[model samples]
Each structure stands twice: as structure tokens, then as C-alpha cells.
Target: MDAKVRNNTAHSRYELTVDDATAVAVYEIRDGAIAFTHTEVPRSLSGQGVGSALARGALDDARAAGKKVVPLCSFIAAYIERHPEYKDLT
Candidate 1:
């Protein structure tokens, strides 16, 4: 599986593409903070780590840009819990 992640800023989402499936982690950027709003991983793409890829990519982007993270989405918050390096962003 050739999966890749991209930040589509115009759409406010970090998209993870695997084969024909695409998962998205939607977010909002405001006042130097990025609030992760939602995560959508299709059933066809479930259990393939697409959601984790999206979460990692989005959080990495936030860190690279020096932006704070408000993980409104439970998935992202949980991801942060698993990856403590990103905790300070919250």
C-alpha cells in the first residue's frame, strides 16, 4: 500500500490517501492555534492505520509550523496521548 498524507490548507484538512481511499482530519486555524475538528476514515479504509497516519501528519504539520493544537476530535486527542511529544501542543 502506497499511502501518503497531505495538508490541504484551503480545505482545512490533513488528508491521508491510501490506494483509492482518502481519510481526512479536519481542523481550524485561529489565533496561533489549530483546532482539530473531526476525523473521517472510510469503512473500506478502516483497520489500515489511515486514521493514525492522518493524525500523525496533522500533528507533525502543526509542530513544524510552531502552532498550538486544540484536539477537539477525540481521535486526535487520543493520538496525542499515545505520542507524548505532541502533548505540549495542547
Candidate 2:
């Protein structure tokens, strides 16, 4: 769907919008780290790699900002687990 993830810092979440549906990866900043708390992809956007995109974008942003990652969200944790390149952020 060519969805691009964007960090909505004012709301503390990463968002991906497509076809009028928005997916979000919610997070909280604590102890100088980004802690992903929840992730939700609209059913319409499921099975389309939207979640992975959101997780990847969020993690990449954290890496670029030099912020440690605390992936409290199961989806995000599993994403990182599968992508070993991001292991150092944990």
C-alpha cells in the first residue's frame, strides 16, 4: 500500500496510514529509552506487512536518535527477535 510510518511525537506513537485506515505503534519514553507499549494494525491492513513496516520504522528512528529500545509490545519484541540486526537496541 506504500504506507510510510511517521512518528507522532506529540502523541508518542508511530503511525502508518493507508486507504483511510491508520495503524499505530504506541510508546512511552522513560528512563531515556523508548518503550513500545502497544501495536495495532487495522484488520484491513493486516497481512500486508504494515505492522512490520511500523516496527521497523520505529526501531530505525530510535537507533538514529541513539535511544535504547524497550520493546514491551509483543509484536515489536518479536519483530526485533526475528531481526537480529536490531538486537543491540534492546
Candidate 3:
């Protein structure tokens, strides 16, 4: 099934949803950057690219907001490295 990435503005968070019940990953934005401060996916959801989707969503949001991304989390940092299109925004 396709995954969905959505922003929860009320909490400054991003959620990656697969199907209808699973929250594959969650992240936060702060200080003009997207911070993958918290991330989790059920064991069943692991290895399904959900984390990457979450990072991408967060980075996209940052770009749309005209802000740089710090990528404090290793996963997010690695994602940025792999997706050079986001480099200029960093």
C-alpha cells in the first residue's frame, strides 16, 4: 500500500502513515530546520522506507517554508546526503 506523510501543525510534527493504523515515523521542526528528533515504526513497518518518507516530507516542508535543515538525526542527515536536491536549502 502507499504511504502518506502529513504535518500535524498543532504539535509541530510530521507523521508517516502506512495503510490506516500504523505511524511509521514522526518528526519535529525547530529553529528554522527540520529535526528528526523522534522516529519510530513498528517492527512490521521497518524496512519499508517509511522513515525516509518521513524525512523527505519534513525536508520538503522546510524547503516550502524557505528554511534550512539541520538534520540533527542521523537518518535525516543520511537522507539529505542521498538527496542532493535539498542541499541548496540546507
lDDT of each: 0.89, 0.95, 0.69
lDDT per residue (tens digit) for residues 1-90 in model 3: 466678787766677767654553344556656656656666767787777777777778778888877666676777779999988766
Estimate, for each residue in 3-66, the C-alpha lDDT of model 1 and write its tens digit.
Answer: 6689998999999888777899999987879999999999999997888878988888888989
Output the lDDT of residue 41, model 2: 96
CA deviation > 4 Å runs, candidate 3: 24-30
How would you encode candidate 2's per-residue C-alpha lDDT over 1-90 as one tens digit per residue? 577889999999999998989999999999999999999999998999999998999999999999999999999999999999999999
Instruction: Rank candidates by lDDT, best first.
Output: 2, 1, 3
**Residue pairs that clash (backbone atoms under 3 angstroms), model 1:** none
User: Which prediction has the highest TM-score against the true structure?
Assistant: 2
Task: List clashing residue pairs in candidate 2.
Answer: none
Where is model 2 more than 4 Å wrong at Cα? Answer: none
Per-prediction backbone clash count: 0, 0, 0
Q: What is the lDDT of residue 31 in candidate 1?
A: 82
Q: lDDT (0-100) at residue 34 of candidate 2?
A: 99
Error of 1 at 30 (Å): 2.0
